[model samples]
Target chain A: MDLNQTIRCIVKLGGAAITCKHELEKINEENLETVSSQLRQAMNLGSCSNKVIGMDWSKRDGVLDISSSLADFDDQRQFTVDFSRFVVVHGAGSFGHFQASKSGVHKGGLSQPLVKAGFVATRISVTTLNLEIVRALAREGIPSIGMSPYACGWSTSERNVASADLSGVTKAIDSGFIPVLHGDAVFDDRLGCTILSGDVIIRHLAEHLRPEYVVFLTDVSGVYDRPPTDPNAVLLREIAVDEDGKWSVVKPTPQSMNMQVEITVAAHDTTGGMVTKISEAALIAKLGIDVYIVNAATIHSLKALRGELRHNIPDDWLGTVIRFSR
Target chain B: MDLNQTIRCIVKLGGAAITCKHELEKINEENLETVSSQLRQAMNLGSCSNKVIGMDWSKRDGVLDISSSLADFDDQRQFTVDFSRFVVVHGAGSFGHFQASKSGVHKGGLSQPLVKAGFVATRISVTTLNLEIVRALAREGIPSIGMSPYACGWSTSERNVASADLSGVTKAIDSGFIPVLHGDAVFDDRLGCTILSGDVIIRHLAEHLRPEYVVFLTDVSGVYDRPPTDPNAVLLREIAVDEDGKWSVVKPTPQSMNMQVEITVAAHDTTGGMVTKISEAALIAKLGIDVYIVNAATIHSLKALRGELRHNIPDDWLGTVIRFSR
Candidate 1:
């Protein structure tokens, strides 16, 4: 089987969902714990489901040997096993944004000492958070290896990913280890240094790895018709994109279905906020991959992660599904 | 000045120096603390000495700017400021050796599930140590960034470094951030995966970065005529290499002078132990760079780090120096 085919999904833990964006380098511990528990349960379910489908395994010389019968298994059974493999990418959130904005690290002027300091500080902050998240996953019996984009020569040119070596990520996934990555301060050809947001990384991974699905776990229920705080705003349960890169509401039978999303960037968000996330989601969806945006702070998100959302749409499940229109 | 010229020295924190190599995953906290303190002091001294030599700096718009007068400073004074920049590469020691050896990760047959698990486990252990060391440096106000060579596409072929992208290391050095690397499990063209030792990394960096000197901190005082455990074994105060890469004892007037070094590897050490270190040191010396081996537990090692041993080797100092024969 192709290694890429084994990837079940690419999960994006939004900055606002996993961290207190308004604070400096503070993690939303409760949210992070809940999310981690959900991930563990989902992975455990995948393993259990695969076993239920009668996947054969034997041990020889202290090494696991998968029976050749696995290849002969029906496609439906093989698909069940794929859910065990996943990649996680997370945002910098409050960890790095404060320092990055203070020194304009995203704009990149490394010649100045402050910018250089900010670049280093931003990396230290984000990588520290990556380590924390990896530890959390490890505590739940998940083998996660933290891969820093900057350390692996991931860079951008004019705020676009020019180079990102995914060999490490693929190799780790193939070896049954989760590779956790995060937004980082990376070298940029045109700017000397710049920020690579988690959203952009997700789109790039979806384009390359081609996961079965993509999940965006944010703080809110889903994409709102207007600013989420507006009294008249409503959740858009489904969104569709046309070949021409146009979006329309697919659920709740929009009164006049003309999507004009109102996105706002927080004061400390060096990376474009909702705008980047929505645009990246649209791009990923255009690749014939379904992208789900849901509130991570709720139990319903666990259903999305467990691959249950594909078959059943619970009435109370408030989220947006961005898919390419056939 | 060239960025490379700013690097005063490359330091190797030997496995036996900072870690209890005989025990699994045990850190020599006292020794590590001493070493960290020495490093911090050396760096602080570098900054203070530069001020004494009349380097000028001014702050504008919250960024420090080095005055143009810095270039006009006499060669001797300019040299003092260069001492501030250095890189650190550490050995895996007790943290990874047990797992790597058990699974034969150094010999690498990643096809086996055991080997793959070992690779991931070894990385997790070593990276944990890297974080601890980085935090220690940070506590002392040193801007240290951990850069795992495996993550950056460093690989080996036939137990030799085949590819190591040093751009990240150089960029970090140029930007005034210390890049901390370590012996790690890396992909190998010949063996699927293998262990890259800190000694080999030190030699590679010395050849590429061309620092003024290199220091190797170990538990023992220095290289000996034989194993230090043997009673008649004498510590070789100095070793010299000819243009043809031949090593000869230069101090204490050897009885026969025909060097027949006896080296041993600890059972858990997957990477060649003393043998590899000496061979790499000789290779580095062949490049006309000086290498110092000293007991990190002693104050004399601090002198070596401060660049004071170059001019005045105290009578009480016990260490071996490897250098090209002029």
Candidate 2:
């Protein structure tokens, strides 16, 4: 397969979306199942039709109603879709964050026994979760292979990805398999070792694979103007990046003069939180590939994954779209 | 930690020793547990003492009796042993051989979907076993990390190992972690993809790491003059390789002129069987590293692993010793 034509999208599963952030090494089984099922449906892995199934569109509150556009089609219709053109990247979430923060693994000092032990412990946790996700995909008939960066010479220098051998990933995708990567502990030239977040991995993959679009599946609806827990917090529906790599709000006109936003990082999160994700998304936007951030808890995320969130803006779509302005 | 001073041994776990070769993906849990316990004891990961305690050496047949030499020591006295200096390489066994053979994965034709699917399936099986083994080691308080060759750019060309990045293995050992690698389906430059056996992996590691010794844990006692099941077959107690890489029976005193023997490969074995192992062991012996082959089902293997089978070849030891004659 010509890789450039075969590669289509990159999906990032936020740590909190599939894992219980408050509990150590705990998986959010319900959300994971939902996401896996949606992925299967989107990929058309097993006996899936392109036609929309029975739905009570009016009941889905606070989303765009598109019943009129699909009124002509029946559920039996089938269509062709490039099902094997995407990759899955997941966050460490409850799996490795606790151990990483406790050992300060992101700030590497391998000489210490405690730090070395922590690094092993962290890999054990994250790889265990990676296998679980791979199994989940396998259950849905998606040939997903767990590709860990640490095992494949992915390293950073001063917290930036300096080297990564991506042949395995490309080979897997070329052979009709989905390569699942994740945030992992990796060697760093300057720091000795550090945590390479899935956000950064996604951006790196986008730069190399040139995916048509990127999707971020988070626990919340989308990026918020402030702490998501605050009662006054409002979702930023659209973001735009300029030629100079600057980001500006394109929807929900700012009521205040300053566009600076506050994003809080969880205590256990060794890698940066929402702020890092947005920054990475902006970088991807600079490549002219639109990025979508959606709540994995809702069906709207599935819509985004199915390539339905593009085109003209819909008032009912509950997510944020970041794209290049020029 | 100084890597040169720390690396002490390399162990290869034959596929038949840890899995049911006749069955599909069936692990020999009992043997695996025994091996894990022995590894823990050798590494001293838990509260284990170096002193031999409460032995009825006279009752044990076929191995050299060492009760007299060890009589001076009491069980209370503990001496230090460098327990963090070994790497493990295991074969695919029943886990991957069937799929690999069925798909002809070793022949390597990537353009075919069946070959690609088989490659992924074979990895799933082998990595599943790797995780189980790692978990088993973890239960023994051993910090074991699963390092897959395919995921890390270990490849072959024309069925010979062409490229393998070993920094992960060295780094793991340097940091006091045991890296567990396995025979895997790796990309082949000439064939497209092929099975890289544990034997070859061990040789590669031995050439680079220069361990003190190498051990091969198999299902049978050791190398035999012919098929092990034959009633007239006898084990080759000691074999020596000369400066020119020629091997000759050192202890058995061959009675026959022609020493060529026959060995059988199980129907499911995609990679070469005992023949390949012996060839690899001979290569390591040519490097001046002694190689020991013993049955994993017996305690003699543990003695070899614990560094007790080096001197005074005892008639009771049920294993084969391969060494250089120079």
Model 2: per-residue lDDT, tens digit, A1-326?
23745577799988899998886677798999889878867766444454322211111222423243234434313322225578999998888876687668899986553455457667877887887787666544466778889887799998999998887788778756788999998888898889999999999999998887899999889877766676776788888999998888877776652444532323213343666677789999999898999999587898888777667667899999999999
Q: Which model scores highest in TM-score? A: 2
Of all true interface contacts, what fraction is found in model 1? 0.18
Against the true structure, candidate 1 has what lDDT?
0.74
lDDT of 1 by residue, B1-326 (tens): 24655578899998888888776667788998889778877766726443321111212233433334234434433223222778999997788777677558898887654565567667767876786676556444466778998887788998799998888788778766778999998878889889998888998899888888899999888877666776666788888988888787778676654444433322213343555576789899999888999999588799888888776678788898888996
Give the per-residue Cα lDDT of candidate 2 at B178.
Answer: 81
Docking category of candidate 2: incorrect
- Chain B TM-score, one value per candidate, order as shown: 0.84, 0.84
- Per-residue error for B30 in candidate 2, Å, reads 3.9
Deviating ranges (above 4 Å) for candidate 2: A1-6, A22-26, A40-83, A256-272, B1-6, B20-26, B43-83, B256-272
Query: On a 0 to 100 scale, what is the lDDT of residue A231 in model 2?
Result: 73
* Clash count list over all predictions: 0, 5
Candidate 2 vs. true structure, TM-score: 0.80
